[model samples]
Target: MGGSPHTLCVPAGCSSSDDYTVPDALCGVTVGSEPLAPLLPDGEKSVCSVSVDKKQAVYVTDGVTDAETDPVAVQRDALARMGNPQKAAVGDDARIADQGGVAVGVCTYQGRRQKFVTLVDLTSNHPVPKRTADRRKALESFLRAYLPKAMEAKGCRK
Candidate 1:
């Protein structure tokens, strides 16, 4: 797939959490494989944006049934990921827009880290109140593949 320079990529061996090396600057990233569902249309994806550093980890999902994710809880978890008892930061509003049937979520863990953005596609079927475990896996996979590129991209962020 062709995209702008800011388009990031995740690395291999990121199938699990402990295997990931959080970007020194950007902790946010898009993870997952392509849609595995026969009913799901091509091009659209169940995107999840995860920002994790040595200080914290933030997981955001869109195009799923759970938009009720508590930012406070996420912040706590993110901090725990880095073994930091203090909460670093949390995006009060994190989501992907369903643009004309294409659902996409983006997360830019700016300020706390360096500068980078992770865009995830959840589905082509607009926003709905439902989620599946498969989608979660897809998100993790995609982010694991591309988070590093986003975090390390120089001159991409403002």
Candidate 2:
């Protein structure tokens, strides 16, 4: 195999939580809502918009609520609402709700102590039923597309 050896990157001085820096803005991450099409109406096309709140740690698309105090708390709350979330093979740590309406992904970036957390919600208007395999897959697909871009923007090793 003709390939270059890649060196493993380890964060320096990563002992304290304060050493990690959270991303101030996520609007720079380029992502489309196309992966989310299946979650919406057949004829409807939804545009993904980032919240401009400076308090938010990452780019929170429309459907996702901005983190007010703690991102980890937000993640815990989202997972709680999911009832039962299936582990996703997306980012560092990810979970997709059984109903396919909610998905949360977490990725740790280089030089930042704070991990980038993202949430996708499709159950805003109505309650999503349980055990929706297809919907869960769709949510997984969306995270597949969204997480990489967001991670790259945050300077994660590809």
Candidate 3:
């Protein structure tokens, strides 16, 4: 809300993508952090953190909606507007807000271990961002630029 239209812009900060090796345990992981696990009876691991919080519209473009776009304020407005459903059905015009944070984390997806830098939503317990191709590519691009400068250790290039 305090910031510009790019509210809660965390600046997409991340650790070095190449900061760590595959730790020998995950050397076979040729693929990135795509989820290889099967769907459980419960809806677990069905989402990624990289995607915007689309449960509801964070900011309504309605003339009466406030100009403030702070993450907390937006969430409050969105939930209130959507009647606080446990799960909200989003429409196309609903614009979600910035997420919890951005960082590179080592995670096991589909049994393959890989490093990924993307926005993570800690409040909701989501690990990485969404598994979409475009999201992955954006994370890869961030890592390519961030890892070199952040890690400085020459041997571990991505």
> How many backbone clashes does every candidate have?
23, 2, 9
Candidate 3 residue spans exceeding 4 A from truth = 1-5, 8-131, 153-158
Supply the global lDDT for candidate 3.
0.25
lDDT of 1 by residue, 1-158 (tens): 22211112265433433333323232332222232221122221123222222211233232211334443344344324322232211122222222111121233334322223333433233211124333344334444444444433422322
TM-scores for all candidates? Answer: 0.27, 0.52, 0.20
Off by over 4 Å in 2: 1-28, 32-34, 43-74, 99-110, 127-131, 156-158
lDDT of 2 by residue, 1-158 (tens): 01221111133423433222222223566555345334443211123332111221112442222323344345666666755676778765577775332333343344434455667655443322222676677678767777677766656533
* Candidate achieving the largest lDDT: 2
Rank by lDDT (best first): 2, 1, 3
Poorest stretch of ten by lDDT in candidate 2? 1-10
lDDT of each: 0.29, 0.46, 0.25
CA displacement after TM-score superposition, residue 20 of candidate 2 (Å): 40
TM-score of 3: 0.20
Backbone clash tally (model 1): 23
lDDT of 3 by residue, 1-158 (tens): 11111111123522533211111111122223322110001121122322232321111111112123233333455434422212211211122222222333233333444333222122323322333233333333333333333322212223
